[model samples]
Target: MSFITLFITASMPILKVLLISALGSFLALDSVDILGDIARKHLNKVVFFVFNPALVASNLAKTITYETFLTLWFMPVNVFITFLIGSILGWILTKITKPPKHLKGLVIGACSAGNIGKMPIIIVPAMCKEEGSPFGAVDVCQSYGLAYASLSMALGAILMWSYVYNIIRISSRDVVVEICASPSEGFDDTFKNSSKQPLLPSADYTSITTVNQSSFSSRMQQWLTTSIDKLNLKAILAPSTIGAIVGFVIGMISPFRKFLIGNSAPLHVVEDSAYLVGEAAIPTVTLILGANLLSGLKGSQIQYKIVIGIATIRYILLPLVGIFIVRGVVRAGLQLDPLLQFVLLLQYAVPPAMNIGTMTQLFGRGQSEYSVIMLWTYGLAAVALTLWSTMFLWLVAS
Candidate 1:
């Protein structure tokens, strides 16, 4: 395809996201009152807990087999590298910009977690349907493309829930601690002074020292317990994670796979139902994403430098690094299909995951800042993705 043609083809899906998100933003307005804060919150809960898991489980169960899994083994590794490199870059950004403590994780997450799910799911198939796609026949390309997209969604969800989730969770907890500690500082000093008073005559210095040591040890243990509790492993192993696990089990285990997945299977109806529900996941998520972006328009105290730093890392640096990494892998003698290689390369160039907004809503911290970041990254994605897709297609096809 000509560069112009490729750019146009690539821009279409991104335009769709932009349009839908705009609708959501409009609906969220008080005058519209369609996707109000309460409605968006409830819809987000449904997406997070229900639609997303069903979508992941159904897609994974339908598409993944042990053979296909082995063939696509590099995908997970590629995704990990994206997260790893983006995270390192995010940390550097944090050190340089010094955003508020609560926003540090949001920044890191925005840097690290690409929009692996929806972008590919929408863009790749659309590209396949275009006139000059390099990925061969339309039906075959779409089939393979959707499979790749599905796997990306599943793995991305798992990582987003676990890695990104924890980073934001810990950062939010730190905010909580700071808020709580500020008011108690004077009380804490008074308590410390009283404790420093001379002990009763009956209590010898040796005995007092032993009591202090024991009390210190107990406090340490209690602190550890509190920290562990705050980790909230339940949030990490969210419904989406559980769904992915179930999908993998059904996908990889022959008997289970036979029982639930194929059309000929006795219980295929259940899988079909799940698939039907899963279809709603993308539109729902995009709508909520738009509504969240409205929050960004309300204005925030988030620094412009931090926003620019995130945009630069995600759009400029990550994509360049991805090209090098994918080429390096090929040079190292691990052959990949042209389409698969393109997908891997494109993975590095996507905007931040929409799930970050959902997570911020869940934690009730950094929502406005995250929304602003999302608005900027996604707004820029139309041009960035078009340009990158054109280059990637040229490179891969050549």
Candidate 2:
């Protein structure tokens, strides 16, 4: 297909995202007050706990088998590479732009993480449905597309909450201490309101009767327990993570696959029920994506140079490197699905992870700055995703 055809096919999905996002933004407006901060928070919880897990598990159960699962070993590596490269670039960006001390983590975190889960979940299947889509029959493409995307979502979540979460936490500690000591920094209202929340969830120290007088063994045990809690291990065991594990079990085990996956199976209703719930994940997420961006418009102290630097790293340079990494692997004799290749490349081009906002909230600073970055990068994402996605389709097809 010509570039125009591919561009049109790619842009269609992005356009849908933009439109729904616009509605989300509109509803979040003060006059509308429908998707305000509290509403978005509760809805986000629903998506995180309920809709997303169901989506991941149901799709994986339907399309994945042990053989196909084995072929996907490269994807997790691909996700890690994106993180590594983005981190390096982000570090370089911080040095060049020299943002405020508190903003360094926000900057680095934004550069390093991409919206690997939500964006792919929305874009991939939509691309498959397009009239000019290169992925072949619509139903087949959509099925396998969801499987690929669900796996990406699962892997991305594990990495983000563990790796990216730490990056923000470590960097934000200084700001947390500063706020605690002074309490007069004149941070934005959101930051001031959330300042009372602990930067890390505090461990109950009641068991330690006297910390200074504690025996070495007792102290060691206390330190170990606090270390585990501070690592935010609970996020690693999130609902989506559990869903992914369940999906893998269903997909890989012959008995589970036979029982739940096919129409002939006596228990296919279970899969159908999960699918019904999972289908809500995509639109709900896209709308929330828009609603979340409204905070960006409220204004903050972020430098435009930093925002531009992040955009360059995420949308331009990262995708270029991805082409080399993905194509190089394929050229060196590893076989991969064309659809998977497209997703790997698309992973590089997505905006920063939306969870960065949550991280900022957790650390009690940079919320305004993160909003500014999200506003610009996501605002730019429509054009960036369309063009890059078009190129990816053409490259894989050729």
Candidate 3:
């Protein structure tokens, strides 16, 4: 089947669900019955701490051999280039399309090249080993792709910050001050507009008389007063950040290296817990994606052109970009195995992320729009991706 035909056929059933929900939303019927917030909320938490951290932890776990480090260095460079491409394309496309001024931010904000975290079903099938194999082996370096994705996360940060920078980049200051001043970008705190809070006396150890004391006490009080800011960057960065610290300590204790993953004690409990939470990542995201879809289906002033453009870029252009990148890498005589090629291209095609909707909701943009676009993006992505994978079977494993 052709890409469009395969996409539409594969997507029709899912399309029905979305259409009904969108119609219901358009009709102003209660959407929460069909759509629930539970999934979004749960996945938001998991992504923030467990899922994202595990991603970082797992990717960074192996010793950074010269070979791996070389790959790591190029990873950021690739993302910086990809970000430039994505941002410029999105900006120019938005300009020509001329969405509303308020929605200009939304349009650019809503679309992205891809997410750092892998969507295995979307990617793996396109890259899996062929049905019959001599050794029953498929080169699956999930970590390598994921590591590149982590850098994608940083590049994504820079891109989004560039957008937000439009709103706040007046006069810069010290790096530490800027980090402290950066607005909350993740869930729960995206809507924060104020920088001051009622000081919890416990979290802040200060006396009332200190307000009238010497300049030293006054400075201390000022520092304490001003320091309370968004806790999310710390929250999201903490798990992996802490994990790295722990991993380093483990590395230093070479004598005890065997004890941790060894046969004797087996840190199986901790291992199991991480696996369980990490496993929850995908389904939790899908469910939230489902609910977000239901809600969006309820209401939208969607431009069909934008939808098609996003779908085309994600399933078509994005992978093409990857192919170009891969060809260049190959032409340079770098040996990137087949699975890696598929994984890299697949990352470029993975659907618009659900976390974006969460952030949009927190920022008080239209929930209706957020939900609807997600419905359309994921729905079409299902088909667009399938066809792309099938058509390019030579690069694909399965």
Candidate 4:
């Protein structure tokens, strides 16, 4: 596809979703929280555990290939880069705006949040599910899942650790252990682990708006205590490590591959549900965003410049970078399928995860401002994602 067409394809999906959502809102069918509530109660659950896990498992079940191996490392590399960039940008953003130092972390956290879990789930299927995607594209998740899983391990751990360490001022070891123990950390516990619950009935999206100093302080204290109480690396890694090692070992044995994959094995389940739930991940994320909007955020927190910069990075810079990387990978003899390329492209296209706001809150950064960033990015995400998907499809088609 020509550059113009590529952009058009990318932009259309988001536009369609937003246009429809706007229509829905105008019709007064539901409030923001109402949508969020529906997402949490219905979509979030089915996707997170059932869909995401199946997706991850299916990707992991395939035989290891050189291309898939390399794709595995890309995400952590991106996360590390994003972290450095976000920190530097945070420093710069804080210097120019001069919000209280106490609040500075929020901006970094917000800008730095990557769509770790959702990106792969949503992206892998979209681009690869079709014929002539990057690889045979049948196994596009091989690329997306590994990258997602690798980064899921890398960044999820880092984000959780950063939250515990900076916010609680805890020992590094303790943070690692806590993250490993908590299934939310990606690997260690990962999405496949039954240790944690992805969608909780107790959740209250409205509470996201309670972002004042007092609330921040309260959260910090809670984080510190949790970190202190939960540190246990051996125990934490035991379940997931065992599951991963045994599954991979059995898969490589060949005789077990088909039988195991078709059966009730965790890996098979991961793939089955990941494709299904992955579809819902973005919408669920959008609802999360909508919930915050309904919570009544303020203007001062939503700086226009920051919002523009973030949107530019998310919609523009990230995908452009992915394009270059994809071309480089293909030229450089990586042999990645086209669908995988699309999924990788998608990994970049997603909005920052909710963790950005949480990290800001936990660490005493620009909690207010970051929360606002999350709000706008996600507000735009529902439509933005659809628009991007359409653009991607057209790009490949052309």
Cα TM-score of candidate 3: 0.63
Ranking by lDDT: 2, 1, 4, 3
Per-residue CA lDDT of model 1 for 1-398, tens digit only, reads 67787667666767787888899888999999999988987897898788878877887777778887787889999999999999999999999999989889999999999999878877787788878788899877876776677778877877887789889988887433245466589789889999998767864878989989999999999999987666656766777767778887898899999999878999999999997887787788778778877777777889999999999999899999999999888889887888888899999999999888878888899988887887888888878998888888888887
Tens digit of per-residue lDDT, candidate 2, span 246-301? 99999899998888888999899999999999999999998998998998999887
Candidate 1's C-alpha lDDT?
0.85
Best by TM-score: 2
Tell me the TM-score of each prediction against the true structure: 0.82, 0.89, 0.63, 0.57
lDDT of 4 at 270: 46
Off by over 4 Å in 4: 2-51, 62-67, 128-256, 263-289, 296-302, 312-335, 359-368, 379-398
Write the residue-wise lDDT of candidate 4 on 33-121 in tens digits: 44444544465456434444443444455543344445555545555655455455545765676654455555554445566554444
Q: Which stretches of candidate 1 lie over 4 Å from their true place?
A: 173-230
lDDT of 4 at 241: 34
CA lDDT, candidate 3, residue 341: 51
Model 4 scores worst on lDDT over the 10 consecutive residues at 168-177
Q: What range of 10 consecutive residues in model 3 has the weakest lDDT sum?
A: 165-174
Kindly provide the TM-score of model 4 when superposed on the true structure, using C-alpha atoms. Answer: 0.57
